[model samples]
Target chain A: MLSENSDKIQLFKYLEGIFTELEQQKIALDKSAIVAFTDIKGNITYVNDKFCEISQYSREELLGQNHRIINSGYHEPKFFRNLWKTIARGNIWSDDIRNRAKDGSYYWVATTIVPYLDASGKPYQYVSIRFDITKQKNQELELVRRSKQLEDFCFIVSHNLRAPLSNLLLLTSMIQESDDSEEQKELIGRLVKPVHLLNETFNELVESLQIRQDTDIEKVNLSFKDCLENAMEALNVAVLYPDIEVHHDFNEVPDLKYPKKYLDSIFQNLLSNAIKYQSPKRKLQIRIKSYLREGSTWLEFADNGLGINMKVQGHKLFGLRKTFHDNPDAKGFGLFITKSQIEAVGGMIYAESTQGRGTTFFIKFNAK
Target chain B: MPNDPMKTIDTLYLIDDDDTYQFIVQRTLNSLNLVNSIKLFSNGKAAIDFLEATLHDIEQIPDVILLDLTMPIMDGWQFLEQYLRFRPRIGKKVVIFVVSSSIDPRDMQRAKSISEVTDYIIKPLTKSKLISMLHESLES
Candidate 1:
């Protein structure tokens, strides 16, 4: 009987030794806060290294304490009250929280609190896991501030510059009306050309500013055919040269919901440009067609004109104040504004050109 | 000036802010013997106020209104709005021409849209264009 009793005692000691080994392994493997306890008062009995690292307190300090040790003043009293209410009712709580460190600096953490029950199925201690995300939050805030500053700068430049520009244009008109001789008129025209150029430069600058600042998009139902008709009407006089021919194919798509005026402007600019930059050897042929693919509409304007060398001008095609063709009327603003207006309405435009062959503009629109 | 047969217009309204522009236009009209009387206003508002007060009086109404688009106190658009309101009271269809140097397509579109605007003449309004405008006005 004495030998049997000793054997039972040795077996119990062996089982206790196994449990100690398992606990040590858990502590080493876990990268999150781990706490162990019984059901009665819910006090922490065991705390891991990660728990001590996050809380900035030693295991001796946190072992007997509850979760109130790392409670940040950032959260309201109601926050903890609600948190305790959720966990006490046998529910797990997962949330993002701001916690205070030992040095009083605040840190953002994504936390998940899981409730553990004792052997009798009664509520016990909780285990929490957290990850730091303070850096990401700061970046988002900085981006918003910078965007607002850019918007303010755009508004001021647009308003102030336009006012003086309008006055200058008016003054030029009045001068033309005056009784100036032929010699004087010629000289005035020379002066006026430079003023016009200055105005064009200012317009390009404003357009660039607008492109950066104006991102809010409003959608409306618009007729594609009507937009084309309007653009043709506006450019009728300019494109009346005997060398230009415009063809349309709108059988596949009819109408689209977009910013109507912008669409017209884009069409007018591109169509006129095709005529303006036509090859001297051949007549201008602009073929406009639309097709549907993958639930989106694609419109193409293929032009037989002074084709661009992609190697040299590809990067600068849509850039502000960039002129490629030798056409005297080219202010280099048409494509820049066209692209901006297209993008502003949540559409996309791309160009494909081969030197001496022609250029084809592929515009994609999100179908309504 | 009133007895001069060549000066047919009763009152000439020059609604422009620029002193130099106003002086040049007034001098041109005087040289051409276009009007018996010339009334100059620095901006659209002063002209608007004068016209709105005298619109009911036939003797006070100007035969022509030369409007400039951009001004400080009131623009040509504001003046047009006021003129349109008092249009019927004046009895005659006052010849209104948009005299602007603005080559902006948007501005040109606006001028073309308005029925009251007889012509969308671009800047440096020449003597020949003004003469043609007068001839068309008389013929109509």
Candidate 2:
């Protein structure tokens, strides 16, 4: 009997050692700024090292004390009452709160509070975990301020630049259509070139602004053939080179309900790029093919052009103000804006290319 | 002004501050021979004054008013509002056409909704479009 009692004592000692190890782990986790609060009628009690640190009191000092002692007075009575009303009904309250530290300085915390119930199923205490988010909040505010400044700058640039551009367009139309002598017409044409360049620059600026503006995505049934025809119409002047050939095969594509302008611009930019960067050795051939794969519409723009060197330009290919080709007309904005416009309306763009062979752009539209 | 009632009925009244636009449009109208006479106004106020003063005296008001949506003092939208108030006073034969360079669809939709606006045309107005407008006016 004596031997059995001794064995039972040893087993109890081993269980106590395991319980203490778990308690230590729990305490270590709580040290990451978790606190528990109880009402005036004390129960299992409040817990947290952060609560002790902020209040300049240990867990022993905070256990029996009401939440009023640590209250920073930053929040009014109504704020606390509303918080209680929400939590007492077994709902969680999560928000950013400013609390006064023991040193009389204030700190911001993102807080989440959860309530605990006793044996009678009545509210006993609340466990609150808080993370320091003051630095992030400050950075966000600064970013907002800087963004507003940038938008203001863009507004000024747009107004100042567009007015002159409108006048230049009017002037060019007047000069071009005017019945002038050959000599006079040549002089006017010479003058029109710079104005055209200015107009193109302004157009690029406006395109960038439009990209920055909020994108409103609306889905409507649109025919692929109609969209292709519209793009061709818009690019009639640019695609006048007799050598270039564009072929479209839409056997698999059905009417899709997607953002129309985004798709239109995507096709326009890609087609224009194909025509703009044609290889000197070969005639430009652009083949557009569409197919449905796994409930998504996949369209490919395959071009026979001076293809991109993915080994070098891949890093900056879709980045703003990045130009890779030696083509004088390359603004480096086409693919960047095109990619953003596509993604803004919930589509993805990818490219496959070799240095001298050709390039193909694959775009996948989300299934309706 | 031309004396023939038929010719005068199809005349254009252009209101804009830009001298170049005025000159170009007048030249285009003459080349096309679409109208008898082209009345010009530098601003909305001048146009309004001309209409109000000659409301009863003039034998025929213009067939079409080519209005610029954006102007120095009074814009096309404001002109429409004020013109509508005086429209009943003027003859019902006149039609207001909003001519603007803005490609914004909202502006086009707004113009379409207005009772007084006959049509919204994007600039720079070509010779064929002007001829088409004359044809439309004759049919209407």
Number of the top-ranking candidate, with DockQ as the measure = 2
**Which ranges of candidate 1 are over 4 A from the true structure?**
A1-186, A200-220, A237-239, A322-328, B1-140
TM-score (C-alpha) between model 2 and the true structure: 0.41
Best by lDDT: 2
- Show the lowest summed lDDT stretch of 10 residues, model 1 chain A: A320-329
For model 2 the local lDDT of residue A64 reads 70
Cand 2, B chain, TM: 0.88
Worst 10 residues of 2 chain A by lDDT: A320-329
What is the lDDT for B38 in model 2?
A: 82
lDDT of 1 by residue, A61-144 (tens): 767776566678778998878877887776787787787767677667776667777787656766665666667766766889
TM-score for chain B of each model, two decimals? 0.89, 0.88
Clashing pairs in 1: A173-B123, A173-B124, A176-B124, A177-B124, A177-B125
lDDT tens readout by residue for model 1, B22-102? 655675678677677888987888998998888777777877778878665588888988888877778875787787655
Task: Compute the lDDT of residue A360 as modeled in candidate 2.
Answer: 95
* DockQ, cand. 2: 0.02
Task: Tell me how far the alpha carbon of residue A21 in candidate 2 is from the true structure, in angstroms, after superposition.
Answer: 8.0
